[model samples]
Target chain A: MTSIRRRQVIAGLAMAPFISRYPLASKILGRLVIIGGGFAGATLARFAKALEPRLGVTLIEARSRYTACPMSNLVLAGERELNQQTFDYKALAEAGVQVIQDYAVDVDGAQQRVILQGGERVEYDRLVLAPGVQLNFDQLSGYSRQGAQDMPHAWQAGAQTTLLRRQLQAMPDDGLAIISVPPAPYRCPPGPYERASLMASYFKQAKPKARILILDSNDRFSKQALFQQGWQDLYGDTIRWQSASNDGRVNRVEPASMRVHTDFDTYQPDVANIIPPQQAGDIAHRAGVTDSSGWCPVESVSFESNRQPNIHVIGDAAIAAPMPKSAFAANAQAKVCAIALVRLFRGIRPEPTVLANTCYSYLKPGHAISIAGAYRTDNGEFSAIAAASGASPIDATQALRQQEAAHAADWFSAIIQETFG
Target chain B: MGRYHAILPMLVLGLTPCGYAQGAPSALSQSASQAAVCSGCHGKLSGVAVPALVSDARVLEQQMLALRQEGGDSAMHRLIHAYDETQIRGIAEALASQKNPPAAQSTGP
Candidate 1:
């Protein structure tokens, strides 16, 4: 064969696994069970079936509908609705996946069974936990589950988001609103900033005299420059950001008086959105996969729990830094995990892996910024390839912002379909 | 005794035949799995101008190779740099070969 033809032949073989069709055998392989029907687990359940039709994939989710946190800020701003962000599992059920509505109380790695809250045990050949994040309410001095009802964190969407919205709407003109951001290694690094922008957007029109004070635990945040610039140009003195060095971190909260106290000062605001510290969800700990950091340690390539065999962890629950815990990251990790599980069931060792993340933060309606990159794992350590990642330029035109905003919306739809459908 | 007879009962004990049928482990394609990751960003934008990968293999290859050649300290470059020419070609072909439903595009942000 000619040299060019030889290279082509080699390339074809390398690509064959991706393109080749497996025989449609209606036979059993093994039972694959997934906990949490969010971005990672749902996508894994869907893709596993696509890869191997006979793989018995069962997804256990406590909630009937998923409200995407990616664009839930829009819902908070009234630009979108909760119903719009919410999605049901009918599509997944139609695809032969057994969707169970129950909380996974415990995961027994030895027996490979997930014990539901109602005392039923479901068996699995492979168990995947994509339980996302659980808020560390104890991290803050006076913050508790009940305290959240009064001073909404609104981080996980649903009721808290609506309560914060109502509070913002009820605030009188010239009222001060406080937003407290937690330190790093949190879900969606840019999320609190996005919420601040949307709240500012609503207040700008509704109560022009209202002001927002952002108390950040970190010295810096994602897209800080772009977000700061947008605040300056658009909101104009309505939003003020304090870095951690300046006592920007909130040390305590007085929910009764609606006051948040920082290291340097205290602010009595009409509305407060306090995003507390976060860790892996409950099931990861129950599965005995979480490490000292309260996050699951996984082999980067397959996302299999480092502490437990036959169980994989993905999304915010996994310790995949350099890669932020965004919905997009979860979706990408799910695909990799699904394929790895499929390969393992067939007794084939999974290959080295590549993953990707594209996080878009809307600074305001019809304007946004994004950071995108690809990741690879070597010897179980994950690293982002800087050459393949980038952020939108700081000095972007309005037209460009509009285009990016459009892209952000399109991405949201795509991801929902990819995960749910 | 036959060699297969020794493990027969173990197979019945271990494998649940009512669920997913077990078969000899076959290697899954790395390119296909990686391409599935791309749909997170590039696929399903109905009216948005994302470079489509599902329609053609050569287009996907050209864009990926171009990004790889246009070397900079960018994230996309670093991502592609991790893969060899063979892997890139495989990914492009895998994306092209997928016959899944076209992602429903969104008209709003």
Candidate 2:
């Protein structure tokens, strides 16, 4: 669940322990069903399996392979192949998750049965939905689903990465590459910024005269200082950003002319990447999961949908702000969810939850910066745990940024090992 | 009754709003700082996979002790093992008073 701009990051964990079957072992709990076998879904399934070998685990994945949103930008930038970002469900299925290669169309969470698009229903004692995100193409005129064919979103990963890469390569040496970034409350808030930097990584060498323009709807963005410094040092004059201050906010766009409409005027380009406003997937809406703000509000601690009692929603779809929607946050959240679910299995009361998130993004090369925070439930709403949980300092030196990058890679490996194979 | 006995020290902790200590704030003693450090790693406090401390003094103490000993030579020993018995109790007590909030309320079903 990722967009070219806001990539979806999910984390899941499963813990399974075998029972010697002392008579009443047959009376154990019902099955657990997880939807959207991305990071969150897959990690939970594995963790749940680790927790209880006999506890049935079912995973509904629309596709067989997972193209991670975390590093997909590397693919689009031609730094890495799609396979590098690609993951197969074989490892997850090998872990005892009853993997289904089909779309989960409806979740009767109240009844704990997930209904597929093909009229198949899978029952569960507990349900987890991490369907990732659905793009809001409607925000920009003329960029329909078909329009994405010529201009790939590459938001969801896999072939889209290839398509976007090809488009970039096909652009003339001094051509224009305009990518519009949607406003806040989107997944991987710093993603569009990272994509810009990574794009510059390629364009700098191949199309030295080509320019990479980011048309941001908002004035402020995640890791702002770091991005600015990176663009200044790395791209020099080749990369540009138009924030709300410059009246550079994109209001709409016409697909035919590859033209984008900002507050003042219109501009056409050789290539366009329009990441429109985003909302939770339609399935979440159909299941009565969202609030008036077009996002899900849960118990703030359990991430249990305020709209539904039994179903839990994690990942970018949930409004777990004060903690931005990032892979680290989702991973933190899925673990909490896994813990609570385990306690529920034994009929134990769940304690209050405290969550933390640290997101790192590099401008380019060895430079990296981060924002870190801790969150806990306060008065039924998730708020920062305390300001004591500080943000990373600005303009860190090369060695420090390099260390952060090293840690970033370690974190990814440790997290992937903990969540998935 | 045992839970109460373990929690009774809090009435005597006299941990003021801020630093009661010299190096660290009296409010955040060595024990408190250590607790903060511990949470830096294991403090996800997620209600699902991890339990929220949530007004449970006895449970928090037991959980802390169990987790501390669960991993022999754990990387978290700096916080978990740095404090004495009373200090450990203080950290667990503080965490207990805290409530559990979902990471995200997830309005969407």
TM-score of chain B of each: 0.52, 0.47
Cα error, candidate 2, residue A5 (Å): 33
lDDT string for model 2 (A239-302, tens) is 7888878876788777765777888988887877777678777778877889987788877655
Give the alpha carbon lDDT tens digit for every residue of A288-403 in model 1: 99999999999988888889999999999999988889988998888788888888888988877778887788888878877787788767788887666777777878876776
Give fnat for candidate 1: 0.47
TM-score of chain A of each: 0.92, 0.89
What's the number of clashes in each of the models? 23, 67
Q: What value does DockQ give for candidate 1? A: 0.20
What CAPRI class is candidate 2?
incorrect
Question: After TM-score superposition, what is the CA distance of residue A44 in candidate 1 from its true location, in Å?
Answer: 0.6
Question: Which residue window of length 10 is worst by lDDT in model 1 chain A?
Answer: A1-10
> lDDT tens string, model 1, B1-109?
3212221111111111112222312225776666667643322222324334334567666666776776532223345565778877776666555443435233322
